[model samples]
Target: MKEKLYTLIIICFTMLLTASCGADHYMKKGEKYLALGEYYDAAAEFKTAYNKTSPKDKDKRGERAKKLAGCYDRINSTQKAIAAYRNTIRYNKADIETHLSFARVLMKNGSYKEAAKEFQLVLDSLPDNELAKTGLLSAQTAQAEKEAGSRYIVKKMDVFNSRRADYSPMLFGDEYDQLYFTSTRNEAEGDELSGITGTKAGDIFVSQKDDKGKWGKPEAIVSGLNTEFDEGACCFTPDQSQMYLTQCTTDPNYPRYATIVTSNRSDAAWGKASALEITRDTLSSYAHPAVSPDGQWLYFTSDMPGGKGGYDIWRVRLTSNGLGGVENLGEPVNTPGNEMFPTFRPNGDLYFSSDGHKGLGGLDIYIAKVDKRTKKFVLEHPGYPLNSYGDDFGMTFEGPHNRGYFSSNRGDGRGWDHIYSFEKPEVIQTVKGWVYEMDGYELPDALVYMIGSDGTNLKLNVKGDGSFTQVISPNVDYMMLATCKGFLNHKEELRVKPVTESEEYVLQFPLASIRVPVLIDNIFYDFDKYSLRPESTKALDELIKLLNENPNVTIELSAHCDYKGSAEYNKTLSQKRAEAVVNYLIEHGIAKDRLSPVGYGKEKPKTIRKKLTEKYPWLKEGDVLTEEFIKKLDKDKQEICNQLNRRTEFIVLRITYGMFDENGNLKNPPKAKEQDNGGSEDDGFVIEM
Candidate 1:
């Protein structure tokens, strides 16, 4: 019996050894496939190994997870890649590589906040990881900036051509017209040798919109400028008389060079191309030329030996004679990653494409507005949607249109690029003016609203500029209203009908000081705290400025609350809040005797709730207020009746002098005090309670 048992154990041991050997063999094969960039096949092998291996083998599980994550990333399964990396981390908590990999996938998925957390974890685990540290800092900065309301809204133009690889958009002089780019669906001028398999040879194509507002079919400019080799990344001078295009020599013998070639517009057609004698070398390649609006400067990308990375944008003076010496754009603009496709707008804004900069993926288009006086550029990313986790390049603006054109291989499209025209928002007659008390100082954060003749109400917050502009449909009359807490609202009727194509209409507002019987809204305070919240300070400051401007205007500070607590207690709380505002004004150098505090607790209901019996004469008493009834009421009325109706307000008691000029026209008043409260003429109004 003992011999028989021993035989069974030996057979079992042999079977176990065979299974282990098979799993190890498949894992090694999977690694080899992964190294060869055969990710699909690698995934299959890895799956086989994973299925055969025991879960107890932590080291093997970690290796399998890493391989699977790599394969998933290659296949563009970002969620799955993230999951695999997380699994690897779970199996081996100390793996900084897995954490970094996870963070990258998170960033690609737009989970920046979470990605930043993972990056931070990697830094904590491996302090010496320079790449991870840089990525973490970038992620953190982006997350913070986004939270701070610094965001770019990109609208994708639906216009596309299914047959072509349209890309590299360049704007011209006209606001609605653009020139953009492609290398597919068009024939080459000379020999049509395909650079990449299955597509026609690259050639620069031009499409124009006629006066009738219709985009004509794109046609390859038949000028001798286009060669059999790749030709693209074209930019036109402001006058549209000259063009700079990238000319690449694909012949293997001269495979390493691309030159910027220029052509003149003669007899309404581009002439023969002449290569600029800038950099002449066998090893260097130059492409993607961008000419400034004034035609005084030209920027192009090159992979020359002295570059900081794969390709860097180099600029040269386009003098009266010809092209001059080249200079690198340097540092923040050029990184260790590939940067190309530089273009400049009429406003001297530099727009370019970069893959080296930390971005969603592929190449992202970045803008650097040139400070002409300082001779410096400030680099910034064109935020999401305008940019995606795909190649977005060649942005062009037509004139100063809010809407422009750019090229992208994003959204629901074939894997090729397409030219899209961005619609610059209609040029509305922006009524840019400031709000001020009878005093000459500007009012900041004043809530400004424009009620159009068509009853369209558009609201805008007055910026520190003390100015507000809201884009509205032009050729209409608008009633502009400005309001701030503790100040009487001001109104002006403007008939802004722009007869020209574009114009600016300015309207100034001089608000009357709140004296006797004025209502103040939006007096917010902290939860369970009598102290004013930061937002409340904004409203209260406005009141202080109004008082300081009109020193003779005495006011009464009032507080109110909805029916929530005992009426007596609510009244006391409200009165305290009102007194707090009065004290704040007094502390800010306003006469303490100029303000009076009062409280109204559930006594004045803004929204009168009609009992069901009153609405339907036969209804019974004691019926509760239904949600439908509440919603039927105006939002402001409902808010004024909610339980959270805690507020502070001001009412002008007396104005020593009436606010208007002798002709009844509003006159700018003088400053009451010269105290420097760190308050500028542009400081917005503040009311805190």
Candidate 2:
């Protein structure tokens, strides 16, 4: 009986040891996940450890609670984080980071007074703690802002969002009627839950706006892009002919790293996807692909080596020769925090979200505009209602306006991002233009100069059928000039009406040939006095604009006289008239070297073979107008012939202005300038198992 009793005691002791060891295993696993930034799993494991801790071991229980609170905070569960932190403080009240973290959660939950007290407690111990000081200030500011009411009315997009997470929206189609986004809903193709989010692997989903202007239910994006593996986060080429999507494949032996893949769109359906050859590293994650507006660069977020930290934005050139080496966007853009979901406005400005930058809290959306002087990005936060103490990102503009849809986890404690529509209520406008030769052929290499009455100047170079687009502000007057080698400069002007509605204007620039003598019409001298007529101001101004537009071109401005004038006298008078025009141009901004005056003095006769001959059948080609010829015509016809013979014209003297190299490429394309605000840094993937 004694032997049996001893054996039973031994069995009970073995069972107790097993339970204790299991708790230790949970604690260790939780620590590993916390280090990996997998807060969801870490919280689960830490909660188990907390429940397993002996009631007498208050220190061990407090440690477990503290770790659980951190995980909750990282995952955006403010209430749960607050509860866990309170439990931790009940035992360990002097932990500085814990107190600061508790204050942060309180601030996020809108408990400003409570948060300030907690932050003060930390400051008492660590008086120089910047995070604590900042937390206190942020909490006070948030409380005040909340009371003042928000200008933006943020409502969750119910029709497009699910109980699960949906984010990274991209607008496509010319009308922007199709919206593509990433989701981890239960209906996703993958059956397994992700270790990161504890949800089904992400899949691409699309929502369409109906004719009634209402968003319909979102459906899984077709085109076989979503397989049994994880696939999400996509961007389309400007033409919408192709897509680059992020895909994460699973392996039992390793952590999944996201890779970017391309798929062609044919007849409104997507073709099979093929992985892009961005890098050979299998361990680094590449996601959040954004194609540059010019279609020459593919930008993505990666956790590769050489990154500032976490995930950094990198871009690779997509050339005809294939993908070029990756470049990292360094410094202010990337910190020791994750920067993702980069998108561009129709203009060249870049918008992205980052947690590294100082903000209210979490990830805040920022606009990065190129600084002209520094040749770097100047970052700006939109402030207040457009941002919150939540993960706000994945912004997409509807055309060129300040209103659009974005993803955010504002009110949800579960960190479930949902689509939200935002509007700035300000008027926005855009201008698009096409440059073509006089013969109707597209000028692919045309240079376009853009200037706004509001002190905006930019140069745009076209590639395809000479076309360019620009964003404009409301109530501004804009002028654009298009020029190409062997083609006369063409000018266009537009005034954007100041209205609350968004507007787009299409302008056409039909450039004439410089190789052919292009006439400067309506350029009449004042009664042979060699002074320009008041009626000629429009034509002369256009000439000045052309000279300014084509900085590299030198033009010989030739003046001609009617055959009735004395040959020697007319030559001297025409020379004076040509020189007058050149002087006027110099007084305005044209360089003197670019303009040269010459006198033709009836040396070049008018050729009226086609259009003029069709109107006046009596006129013939290569006809030189003289006193005898004018006398043969009627009074009306005689005056018309004389007027046609006496005009100003310009022909190409040299097409190789300093504007282009010997190979015909632009030598001085528009340099990066800052209007106001705003690497191939890649990483090697490490197996994080």
Candidate 3:
């Protein structure tokens, strides 16, 4: 029994020794790879070591889990990182950093509420930890940010993306048709997968839009510029003669750090590239180059010493000889976490991505502009859709247009970045004018003459529908005159209001006829009263203004009543109504001689117009709405037709009213008389002058 016990103890000791040896080997490899910034390789090794180590060895297993979680986080494997972090906290529940990291991954996964619980846990121990507080705030507001969306219309550019990651779009060339971007597709020149990202290295690729405005299949740039190492996030000078790109040269023994390089265009293609030495800080990593529109500043991201914390955006003077004036952007722009992928608009607005800012988790895109008052950079989150709970960065605009392309890794479970297009539709101001004869259909032959304060003079021909549309400048006042043969001219003054969204201003030109009576719209009277209702003031005021505008024109005001009332009663009633309108017009700065009052009573019924027929489809156009015709219809239709007939209208008596002598200004048409009472202008409407 003693001999058997000794043999069993020796076997168990050997098994323990073998397990320790296997786990230690993986642990050492993981540590080495992690030091070299090879996150993917480190994750694989650490995961293996965590599985191989004895479950009873909590210390070793917890450390291995923590390292594995860090590696997964670096590569943006959110689920894996979350699981690894959970395992780490389970083994070593007291590690605040592990809980903090787990919360951050949860935020990236859009589990903001859950992430807040973990951040609160971190704050329980380190009460003043800024990172935990910021993370907690971010988790709380992420969903709210999603509800407040941006004006930008974003769509995934599947044509620009591939199965692997593609990002950092740059629009250049004279036409802005040549699109350059970074892609980690199979076409990349680098053969081996990147130990840093777990995918092949990203390379610069170009896709040209054809004459038809369609993007072609992307092809890798075959210039001497591309190398076996990582190359991406490129930008060009204003002239696009020089291209600056981020390059990462690999050395298995040492860590790989990104550096900026420049390549000059020769005969259309970039020639050999050379390292762009910004600062002598060889230990720092620099990437994501963006050149200003004026080519005076070269903005880039770096992790150099003296940085606020993680990678911060820095700009340098793009001098004739290399670059200088390295500035850290500071305060509101930079934070303890990463701020990268700085871009610029044509209007000098700075756009960048930030993981440290209060945002919707991961890296959210923000617009930064210098406040004219404070002169300090003010950062603004563009809101959700323009941003998401994923790594959204890299934006490029099409010249002065608000539309452009950007990058995001929102929905891809594989954690691969993809290209997306965004556009804020431009607001256009237009003046739409409709010309027609009064009490008639549209006048398709009408001509509109327009003169603007901004030296805009145009003669627009009306379309078949008697409508003309013209793009109007904001803050410009325009005078438009509508004219048709044998019809009196109508004038309108329009002021284009300043607006930030698309709008169309409508102007109606109802020309007075030389041959027919014109109905004044919106005039109303109550019961049997001759006095105009309050609602009739708008239409009456318009008529008064029209007479004042066309001072040389004279009109005979007439009122008609429905067929329900007796002819004599309607005659007296309409006569009083017409006289009341004339009195109101004369009271409000109109020449009394320009008006003549008459009552048609029920002698001529209302003729249905095309507009009326559209409203009441039972009625036919040009049909007179007599008592017989109205009685055939339903009670609703009869009442509507009767309401149409009870209206005040006018006929152009003469277009040369006050044009002759100034004193004979036709002050009162009722008191004017140079003709017989039997004639056209003297049909009992004139009292002797």
Best-fitting candidate, scored by TM-score? 2
Per-residue alpha-carbon lDDT of candidate 3 for residues 551-590, written as tens digits (9 for 90 to 100) = 8788999999998768899999999999989999989988
TM-score of each: 0.46, 0.64, 0.63
Global local distance difference test of model 1: 0.67
Higher-ranked by lDDT: 2 or 3:
3
> Against the unseen true structure, what C-alpha lDDT does each candidate score?
0.67, 0.79, 0.86
The order of the candidates by TM-score, greatest first, is 2, 3, 1
Q: Model 3 misses residue 38 by how many Å?
A: 0.8
Model 3, residue 234: displacement in angstroms? 0.8
Q: Write the per-residue lDDT of candidate 2 for residues 24-55, one digit (tens) a residue.
A: 99999988776665678889999998888775
- Summed backbone clashes in each candidate are 20, 20, 4
Q: Can you write out model 1's per-residue Cα lDDT over 504-597, one digit (the tens) per residue?
A: 6677776765532334546777764566666767767767766765666777788877666788987877778888888878888888878888
RMSD for each of the candidates:
25.2, 12.1, 19.8
